[model samples]
Target: MAKNVNPTRMALSRLKKQLATAVRGHKLLKDKQDELVRRFIELVRKNAALRKEVEEKLTTAFSSFALASATLNESYIEELMTLPSNDMTVEVIEKNIMSVIVPVMNFDYEEDFMAQPFNYGYLNSNIELDDAFDNLATILPLMLELAEVEKTCQLLAEEIEKTRRRVNALEYMTIPELETTIVAIRNKLEENERSNITRLIKVKKMTQ
Candidate 1:
């Protein structure tokens, strides 16, 4: 159906301009959506890998901790672990990916997290306790990375959906309506010109 527009040359000019703008915007939005999907897929793959690795390390860490608990007194183990070992600072920043601002995380520690996290006597400490602590420290960065990737995936998914909606509106609705209106107006103008020419010829014949 033609758009609700006046069938005049001025209105046609304006609608044609609008159609041009809408077509350009549609192309740009479609391109952005494609790139966002590409980036989202990449992040999804990375998220899967990191999730697997983190889960594996977490399982290992829990197993070692459990073994250490069995060997050590529960109260003593809790007391030892309750003391803070490393000073950690987490910095959050945003990076723009296809106009979607996603989070970037940085973990800074004052001391080596991979080092022995306990300040207790070596003779009293179980090997399993040290192994568990090491594994936990090792996976800290991976956990943060997984968080970032997951959040990025969510944000990209939302932006891609939004862009797709806009592209569809322009491609299917707005552009088509404008084109129809332009055609209807052009046909009206041509019909009016023909009528005017025919009337002039009739008058000339009558005068002759």
Candidate 2:
């Protein structure tokens, strides 16, 4: 690439301009990559915490539900779970972080007919069933939060990789090639100037 550039003042000027732009672009991309890395790390940490919390809660909720199921008639438990008293809608919205669009989930619940377990009756329901329902409902938002964080982390990580690649291309390849072409042009111009001066001196001596 450097060898193909014409070694002249005009070429030197053009090469210098390209080099400056490349350097500036490299700096900006490098900064972006750094910021993305920072954000990705933070999101990863948050995701880990949320995942752990959600896992623990899910285990507890399921275990409690299982325990309650063991004592209750299978047909009755299935009937109770089949009809949900609450309506839920999940709305997804996009949020920008470091120019990356990540999703934020919001759950909108309709009017609650019954906010507690055994909404039909407490006669046959155990305390474990109540505890299970409470835990499950409480973990809903946490699970959504975990999903958001995880997706954000994934997107940030991808952007970081792309930015790093571009930065490397400018810093290592494009900028260096331009600078080398500039140097070659300047050297060629200087050599021509000396040759002209020497030729003029010889012509003067011959004229004298």
Candidate 3:
């Protein structure tokens, strides 16, 4: 929208003062846009790195489980058949980072899956392999967390776009409109002053 502010000779000082304020506002908004873009890109790179590590570890965990299953006695494994498979627990708590608090998930394992003779407990050698599996499972929630961070970056980018549009409109349209109006008013005032001076000189000569 074009600004319709009228500035007279007496009001030039006020218009200049307000223009200074508007210029400062434009600079501040520009700075904000630059900072948001910088941070958003940084988060994207971090997300890529984290995903790579999680995938590699997850692949290793899966292969370990396959090896364990093959090494154990298939027929003799009936004793631990009742043990849980998808038996994991997690808790998400909030923690702050640069004024934004994100969720952190904690993993818990269900122990005592099988209780029997001393030699009939879980596969002891494979317990570390299972622990590896659990650790990778823990990374699942963090992946979901990275998903959330990525979403936040997208939203912030959108807001920055809208703000930039408004700033451009003001700098290119509104300020120019005000300046044109002020210049027109000053020219009219000077023309009127010259007309009055000519009239006063002619009247004085006629009286003489």
Best by TM-score: 1
What does the lDDT read for residue 34 in candidate 1? Answer: 90
Report the number of the highest-lDDT candidate.
1
lDDT (0 to 1) per candidate = 0.89, 0.83, 0.64
- Candidate 3: tens digits of C-alpha lDDT, residues 1-208: 1255443556766666766777788788777767767776887788788778778767776777567667766554444445545455767676553333455656554453222211334544466445544565566666666766666566666766877797897789767765766677667667778888999999999999
Residue-by-residue lDDT tens digits, candidate 2, 1-208? 3656777788888878888888888888888888889878888888999999999999999999899989988898788889777777799999988788999999777445226533667777888888888888888889888988888888888888889889888988888777777777888899999999999999999999
Off by over 4 Å in 1: 1-4
lDDT score at residue 55, model 3, on the 0-100 scale: 82
Give the Cα error of residue 114 in candidate 1, in Å.
1.7
What is the TM-score of candidate 1?
Answer: 0.96
TM-score, cand. 3 vs. native: 0.61
Clashes of each: 0, 0, 0
- The better candidate by TM-score, 1 or 3, is 1
Q: TM-scores of all models?
A: 0.96, 0.93, 0.61
